[model samples]
Target chain A: MKQAVEELRRQAAGLLKEERVKCVIGWTQGTDVARAVPFFATSVRQAARLTWTPFCVNNLSKYLLNHRYDNTPLAVVVKGCDSRGINRLVQDRQFVRERVVVLGLPCGGMLDREKVLRVVDPGAALQEVEDRGSEYMLRTDKGEYGFEKREALLSKCLECEHNIPVVSDLMIGPQVPSPAGSGIDRFAGVRELETRDPAVRSTFWDRHFARCLRCYACRNVCPACNCKECSFEQAVPGWQQGACWLSKRNHPGQNYLFHLIRMFHVAGRCIDCGECARVCPVNIPLRELYRKVMKDAEELFAMKTPGTDPEEVPLLSTYRTDDPEEFS
Target chain B: MLVSRLLEYVGLEPGRFEMRWISASEGGKVAETVREMTERIRKLGPNRKMRDER
Candidate 1:
């Protein structure tokens, strides 16, 4: 990991000094090695803060879509799953591929915070963690402990195939072999619900949507949900005005519709990077919504999204005259 | 409305297509649109056949 950081430091400094990129977005130590936060380095000095480790789970490309700074080409460090998002944006023609320079980092797998929290006490002030081959050595205020890498790994890591990155302009580190099926069965919960009657399904969704805060964190973190004006915020006939907040009967069925419509809109385009699920404060099974859509696209249209060339017309935007509609 | 208006402006030959607006307020419009569109599609024939002849 240190070797990768040293190599990235050199490359990032060069990109900044040459003004090739307006900024370089990468993870940096946040108070501790266990809490790496996204750092945007505009200068060579800032590049020194850039580091990589198992704890870097947040998809940094989402910061790029936010346009938090002035619109300029950015140099971003992307893992395999993160690269899929870049591919999706390009495939959807939402962003020009030329604007970003992706530094593909071959990740063995990232630590899932949920999994880590399950093992370590939530209040434990973790200071540093050393990657010791098979086990990670940790230093916390409570005490010191060593944990197997497998135990702390994110659920997504269990099925990761793109740990070394499928696409990047400059690659660093020797490629590591990723697992065959990193738990990509994103629709397990949804399929379970599908077996139930309509009333049962309605009750299931009612319980989940009943807890929604309407914070829009799910939509905000979504890579494919880059709309100028979201439909949920509209007034005058207001599709989802009264139903956004978390209250009984206030949310109504529109909350479910809002989710359904959004999922369908990005059906073939979802990269399944887990950003929507990660960002949901209320912890709704949002991944299940899009995962079902993705499964349908793969089965019915034989379409794989975002990772392909930009010229291929998306399934939603294009249709066939001889399309199989006889079943209807 | 957009579909009908566009087809009208283009001056398409009669029976080339049919268009309708199915509002959320109207439940029957859903079935009506589906039936009407199906009829128009049948009249126009299969799209692949039309493309091949052209």
Candidate 2:
């Protein structure tokens, strides 16, 4: 892990000094040991502050949309999941492929902070974490402790589609094997929901969406949501008679409406990176909403996973006459 | 309402929507109408509504 971090810093510095890229987007240690935040490095000297850790959870590809046309080229550090996001934007024609350099960083998996907290004593100050192949050892004020990878891994990482990258300008780190049957049964959660009685399913979703804080973290982190004027975004006071279908109310019905509409908006485009579920404070099974759409698109239209190929047109944007029309 | 909402969500051709009812005794007409609709839709190509969204 240390060797990979050293290589990343050296590469980032080289890119900035040589004018290969205008900026380098990577991860930096967060204020807390349990988190790693996104870092933007514009100069070679600032590159030293860059890092690669098991805690680097953010996708980092969403940052690329803002740099779409800053004139000079930009580079973004990406993990396996994030590369799918880059593919999404490029496929959507959001950004030209030549403008952004992709630095694919290999990731074994990421640990869930909540799981880590459960293993450690309350109020213990976390110090450092050592990544052993099978488990991660955490050093805290209370004492050193080790947790197995499976028990500590984030739900998103357990079913990781790829640990290296399908596409990369530069690749680093060792490959990690994906959990078996995870790819085939990606829609298992959605299928479970399908089996429930209509009333039970209604209650299930109602119970979850009722807790939403309307924070918009899920939409903001979503790579598929590239709208310049989102329907859910708050409008400027009185300038227009629109901009929010969600009506500012925090009613449970309104919350359910907001989530359902947002999910439908990104139906065909969602790459299933699971960033929305990761960032949600209320732990909504938001991925299941999009996954249902993804599953239907695959089965009904015979659509493959989005962003896996750059040339294929998006499913919703293009359709075949032979498309299955169950409702029709 | 749900069908229109779906069409708007995907930003597909709104008027491309089609519905026709044939009496239960007229299975041949239903099959013939479906074949004609398929040909027309295939030639129209993909929806332009998706590209022109606000």
Give the winner by lDDT.
2
TM-score of each: 0.73, 0.79
Residue pairs whose backbone atoms clash in candidate 1 = A106-A164, A107-A163, A112-A154, A158-A182, A159-A181, A159-A182
Q: Give per-residue CA lDDT, model 2, range A1-328, as digits (tens).
A: 6768888899899999999998999998877667689999999999998888778889888988786666669899998878888888988777888888898887777888778767766566656656676777777788998878777888677767777766689886555555323445766777877766645666677678778898989999999988776777647786345444557567676676677778777877888888999889998988877777777778777777777776767787886777655443
Q: Which candidate's DockQ is highest?
A: 2
lDDT assessment of candidate 2:
0.75
Tens digit of per-residue lDDT, candidate 1, span A37-126? 889999988988787777887787777775533458789899888887777667655656778889998876777665566667767776
Each candidate's clash count: 6, 0
Q: Which candidate comes out best when scored by TM-score? A: 2
lDDT of 1 by residue, B1-54 (tens): 222221222222334445445568988878877777778878866632112110
State the DockQ of every prediction: 0.03, 0.05
For candidate 1, the docking band is incorrect
